[model samples]
Target: MATEFEMKEIKSGDPEAARHSSMAAPQKSVTVKFENLNYSVSIKAKKTVTEKVILNNVSGMFKPGKFTAIMGNSGSGKTSLLNAGAVKGGKISGDLIINGEKMDTKFMKKMSAFVMQDDVILGTMTVREAITMSALLRLPPEIPKSEKLDRVDEIISMLRLDKAQNTVIGSTRVKGVSGGERKRTGNLIIFKIPAMAMEMVTNPSIILLDEPTSGLDSFTAYSVCTTLSDLAEQGRTVVATIHQPSSDIFLIFDDLLLLSEGRVAYYGPSSAVIDYFTKIDYPFPDYVNPADFIFMHILNNSEEAKQADKKKDALNKVLLEWDNSENKKVMLNTPATQKGLPADVMKVNASFYEQFRFLLTRAGKNVWRNALMVRARLGQAVFLGILLGLVYRDVSSRPLKSQTQALGIFLASVFEDVQVALFLAPMLIMPMMVFSGFLINNNNIPVYFNWIKYLSPIKYGFTAAAKNEFQGLVMTDQFGSLTGEKVLDDLAFTDELPVDQNLYVLLSMFIILIGMAYMALWRATKKVV
Candidate 1:
């Protein structure tokens, strides 16, 4: 019987294996190497500030065609190491090399895919729609839409998600796909290792996952591990910070970097870890799971101060042993030299306009499918419109009292629409509307509170509505009657601005608010390293 590695080797040599490869884009080899990496964060207590070291002198290499698992106890800096290595923004000091060359943050962001633990997916979209939209946005603009869609289908089939391809990804408030499928949707490459191996639409050289098997059952965890292993076998460099994995799952990793309190306890092939510990006179008992034993041995002794000190000494011995080991000397001591990388791999294919158009189309589809949210918004708009129409019926030809009522209703409607669309909270809307000139006379407002009217959307709405309504109308007020101009003067709406000018101001505010909302959504849904 052939081992898993032997089977992978056989598959690589088989000509038929190419048939299963992705046809969407060509795959490129990526090697990620980090040396003497250290990360720290500053914390302030009262007037004094202190820097907390998160990752201390961490170093490792992730090569193409291999899966590296970083395991550690809670607060062991596994995540810190992963983040530092991704070239993301932080207080990190290290030498990070990609494909034997020092790459910039922009290159890393463009060429790599980082899948965080929490699944960030649009609940309104179906499995196919989400993946298809991602392909459209991430793939090079030169790739045809048809070809990009073919890649989506290939990824769906490769990940064994064909059954749920059209199923909606439901959220807590909505009903949709399963947790496993949701996780798969978050990382397209690992979800469909075969398709990624053949040719992914994005064609990322390196992939990083933070706790890919977290919140999964034994069987599901095993399946996820198998998929990651398959991704590594296809010549992609895969690195993941895993939680407590089962014994069977642990064996699937090609390399292991065990960390304890931001320090390396062991770093080498997974098969050699047990032997390394045994050589230090710490051997696993008969029939004991090596992964469980390793963690237990490292952390089990850290309960009391004396035991913790002893455990620290033991851990240091292992770290020192690894430092002197032949594997470490060969893998870590050699400095990486610059190598030419593929132009396509480093280039971002899509233009800003293309990304915006694709995002807009996807957002429109999401809104369309989210029937409950759509109905709610439409219902509010229609209800408010009808209510305003009834309250201010025929005010264009009515007396001053009716016209004033009409102005109030119109102002309220505008403010309400803007509030509902932008803030999405009545708590915030009510206060802003109260301070607006419609409900309270601007002259009577306190000096400090007078600034609120200028910043309030309701003030702009009321001003615009009043100007449009009373511009040239005749009114019947206390002095037997007055022109709309006189009424505007009495109400202190004497800005001398034209109706079109006020409308333009309102339109500008609306555009600004919409832009802010878009930025918020982008930040919330964006990938985190």
Candidate 2:
């Protein structure tokens, strides 16, 4: 029987063997090297500008088939160094070499994926739904739907989320899946790749993570790291910015990159770290967690370190000690570069129409599953319609005819939250009712300030409804004949819009409002950073 790594080698060399292996296994790998990488931002204070350095001259290498951990004390520029790979509105100068050849930002972006610390999955979706939606959007177009689904199933099984596949990842309002399952469900792949379960991850050749285990518990943290290690073992280079790890979790890491005050304190194998530090007079004692031991010494110089400067500037001495160490001589020797990457890497598999259909299907599913919200909305419509008829048993007696209900839909798109629309809807609609020919006759308004009614959607909707109900009717009861035309004249509506014109105006308002909303959201997404 061959080991897993050996089996991966076999699959890569032989097409026949590849067909039988797990599809989630990495198909390619690349070395990620950055030399003298620096990231800074300009801070203006009191008529003077100063450059605040986040990462200062940091250099390191993460090789293929290695689970490298980038750990440091809080505010030590761990996230800054990791994010330097994908510079977003920041002043960054660095040499990023992939497989020993310097690559541009465009090429670097296509080759790697960054997984943030947050697990942001829709609480309404099931585990399978979340993963399948990603798979449908990404994964190569050549692969059949049936095969893509099969790969999704394999990923579900690998993460041991088979039982929770159909469970809803619930929010704080409602109880649903377990915390661990919720975390795992959120780990779906983000970029264009096979929907491999990343759990706050994306499928890219070089995976850089910023604190994958931040909010997780001891056992869950270990489990998350184990999955990362599995990905590394499958030949992909994995880099993660991790915090205080348990001894067991630390042991899972192949290489360790330690930093202090924006400088590389040590960069080498995890096992050799003890010897590396011991040679510099910082000896590690037995029967203590290696992570805790390291943090105790290094974090002593950090800003928040309790009683900092117990000794004279421990940070500078430790950093200087590393500058003269033999480990500093180690350099990134990237493997031979590939002529080209896989065609399906980060490539969209479906056409626009197909993607739209899938998105529509998902929208339908979300609406169906949110039964409470749907039922509440339906109940409101039925209850309100009946109440309106009761209050105004006769149509002519009704006081309100609001057409701005569609404004809620418009507002929802603009605010990007339904609750905001719901809260602000009544406040806006009440003014339209009072000012739009409902409270007093239009002709009785002040001459200088009488133009507000034209802004009211209620003005047109009410006129249209009244014309539709009593346009040709004539009523007489021991009084002069009251024709519908006479009623309109008395209400100062004879010069108002005709029924057909009012109907058209309302329709046009709805369309224009909705179109503006769509444009607002589309523009918001155009921002790259």
Candidate 3:
């Protein structure tokens, strides 16, 4: 199994230390297994909170040297289960035993690369740069830099991305790598922006992807799956959530985990699924594609439900059949144990200067390359500034504008607080929903909590929006012309701060939030060295 990317270590001529380091010194094989994993989230609506169950009693194992696909119709908790295995955290309860130890976000982040479905790698860098920079940042520093770059080159070759090495992970706006090449980087691309797609270049032994093949051609999707298969060959635990793959793409996955209504309907080898379904009384026709047949005939909760409603009883029966079958026993009976490499492989090794230099360079490039961002932001400022200028320019006239100012840095710092923002970002932003003004009147809130309105950027932004929409103008009706001032007074916006004050608040908050974000990142990088 030794290749250009791997090397033999000779440490004091000691066999035990070499065994502990495993393959070499940086990357080691990982086995991730979980059982009784139940995940749910509390969703708040108009006036009530409800728990939405995503994964129920889901038990599965993604072993090293296996390309596993978790497939189900929309809302089958495929993404949920993958995130669980990634240990990104949710209202999840289970034993996620990695290398025979129950790990946390810190350790998992060290040993795994999670490519979310959206907002993947930075779109500005070239394919080689993305992978190379990721290696420089995440690989153990004890290894020489040249060897790290060599490993990156090996990965690029494995992914067949060497031909597209210089290509920019482009977006719909910027010309860059092809869709297939982007997906092949072993990362997720949202079809609009090109992703760095070099999640594999890190020391992370485990890789979790959500729809890496989404938005690609059938051949490209198959090719991406094949790249994952190659990673399995390299002894990495590869797990991804795929949707409605073609027969060829389906054939590429060594194992399959099918879910329906937050429950495990099937979990086993991809080739065995047809036999399993056939044995459960749902016969597969000779010419029909098993995937399509399973979706329409077996899973009543699938997006493509036809007579699936009538098949609800039948779906329950199928679930029961799988639950009671020996396949479930085999899946649960797989030994949950393994040998782990040294702890150095489970930590990011980079100097603060290195991280800052890379980040600043990336940001500078992003700003320089993306002229539209600057131009659009300038256009918005000009328009909003002119709008307020045309108004009486009263200190009490306009109000809160949230998204344009400090929200990103504020939310980023908050997300960094928890260290895992996969699902936590939205969860952290839940307070915004309550404070958004339109959802609840500021007056109705209790006096002790009423001061929070001062902190709610939505209040100020909505006031400005309301003022811009209704102030200084008149509405004409069949009865008479009503002054916009009357409408503003009626909405109680007259009591709020004016355009000038709102700008000051947002500007100050933006400045402060930026400082906070900088400190948060600085402290984080301060430890890496």
Candidate 4:
């Protein structure tokens, strides 16, 4: 019986594999490289703000299948380099080669995934639900539903996140998924690279994380880096921008690309970086981390260093030359760095309809499972209705004096009820639902939607309440008594069933309120949170 790894090897072999068992199989490697990369953001001020360069003449290459860390001082171009790959906005100039092909920004976006420093996961989605929607919407336009599920399961297994797969990303109100799970969820969605799941994750070509360990505990950070190191060994290109990493975490990096004020101060294997720094006249003191030492050197900016234009120019030139060298390009060699998913994994006929169904399915499951704080919302709406009903149950016998007074009370009560309905409906429910839907779908609504008023539960509730109270009330009697008997005809008691109508109206309003609440929430959360 063949082992799983052996099976994978046999199945992954090319068509010629069956014909020549003794033939030497050609080795695969990542041909990813970069040249003359530059990114600069504009500082627009009311009165021409001074220009500050973020990334200056930055050029570097990332070897495939290596755990590479881009480190620098606060303003160092570490993140800017990652951003220059895609989505990050700025004037950019450079050649990025992936798989021996010059990478355009658009193509790079498809080939790479960029993770930001902040957590962008929505609150209403469960861990599994979030990853599933991502797989549906992001996977190349050709993969099938069955394959997408398989891929999601693969990612869950790869990240060791199966434990929290079903947990909602709850907020402060309730305990929810852990930060690591949330981060992994974001990664699975943003980066649609399928081969990443089966491969060990050290240096990943498909995944580029910005400050992966920032703000995490030491143990967690080290664990993340350890997993990343494993990925690198599997021949994936994993590039990350890290700041002030712990010593234990620091040990995990295979390579370090250190920058100071947009200049490459060090670019080599992590073990050699400290000795290289010492040779360059910037020795690390005892107990001082090499990462921190490099950062401090760039941020020092002493009067002598600042004033010596010649030294600065020379440093800049060395940095530029080192960055443009050919050895850096050779470092990216990894077996699976350029090996994409098999044709079976990458589909061409994946349609918007199918993707939509997956999104819809994931969203529906989340709603049905009540995994999205829905119970709390449903409970809140019911509680609000009961509370408001009990608070303002009977306003039928209130005085109505002048026409102005009647208008005031009527407007106050109806509008107040409308406001309450609108407030609770959109407020309690909108953020989570809006968060859920818009989190995946890019659909937009007009700013001034007249139809929205028709859809408002507050409008329905307010109107229903008004109809019950004043559908047949004597407008004149409600005010002061009129001087003529003709007014009495209008005020005279009629055969109308006011009490029953009030009861029906109240019930209708209550039902409509419930329906509207559900509808708004339903539309909002009908996607990954």
Give the number of the best model, judged by lDDT.
1
Which 10-residue window in model 1 sums to the lowest lDDT? 1-10
User: Predictions ranked by lDDT, top down?
Assistant: 1, 3, 2, 4
Model 4 residue 136 lDDT score:
61
The digit string of per-residue lDDT tens for model 1 on 46-86 reads 99989899888777888777889999889998877767776
C-alpha lDDT of candidate 1 relative to the true structure: 0.71
Give lDDT tens digits, candidate 2, residues 342-440.
455556557888889988987887677776768988997787568555644443421122123223222222333233346458777555556666466
Strongest candidate by TM-score: 1
Write down the RMSD of all candidates, one decimal each.
5.3, 7.4, 13.3, 12.4
Supply every candidate's count of residue pairs whose N, Cα or C atoms clash at under 3 angstroms.
Answer: 3, 2, 10, 19
TM-score head-to-head 2 vs 4, winner: 2
Considering summed lDDT, which 10 consecutive residues are worst modelled in model 2? 1-10
- Per-residue error at 369 for model 3, in Å? 2.4
What is residue 197's positional error in candidate 2, in angstroms? 1.6
The segments of candidate 1 whose C-alpha lies over 4 angstroms from its true place after superposition are 1-27, 42-50, 187-200, 301-309, 323-326, 334-338, 393-407, 410-456, 476-479, 512-529
